[model samples]
Target: MNLRVRVVHCACAGGRHWYADIDDADDPQPDDPFWFVDGCATQTQALETACGELLALSDRVVRGDWLPRVLEDA
Candidate 1:
């Protein structure tokens, strides 16, 4: 698969910024991860799986974490 991964900057109201990556598994790796590709199948299949993974991850992020609050609060 030829997948693309991009890092997006997420900013908050207090001017805090965070790193967020949006990746498509079907797209070729934009960098060195190509070595792990393992000659994957068509892009369409890869993209579908990647989308599922991304959605699951987003759910976790919204749940928030205690350590995050401690650091940001300080």
Candidate 2:
């Protein structure tokens, strides 16, 4: 289960990175684990949202086909 997160950040080009922070990853290399991204945010609200979403993404990645715990279907 590869849960890749596409984050919108300023320093994403070149060798710059903004990615996931999982403890276990596919490729072993010298890279910062971001859930799926990196970079500094200016707004608190956006940062909060990113943090929350990243957590969810992490759960989804590790849990495989497990249903989302944050919501219920009608």
Among all candidates shown, the one with the greatest lDDT: 2
In candidate 2, what are the lDDT values of residues 1-74, reduced to their tens digit?
44333344455446443332332335465244433334434434445656676677667667774443222322
- Stretches of candidate 1 off by over 4 Å are 1-39, 65-74
lDDT of 1 by residue, 1-74 (tens): 12343433334565533332343355454333221121224444444554555565556556752112212434
Query: Root-mean-square deviation of each candidate, in angstroms?
Result: 15.7, 9.3
The local distance difference test score of each candidate is 0.39, 0.45
Error of 1 at 8 (Å): 18
Weakest 10 consecutive residues, lDDT, candidate 1? 31-40
Query: Distance (Å) between predicted and true CA of 53, model 2?
Result: 0.6
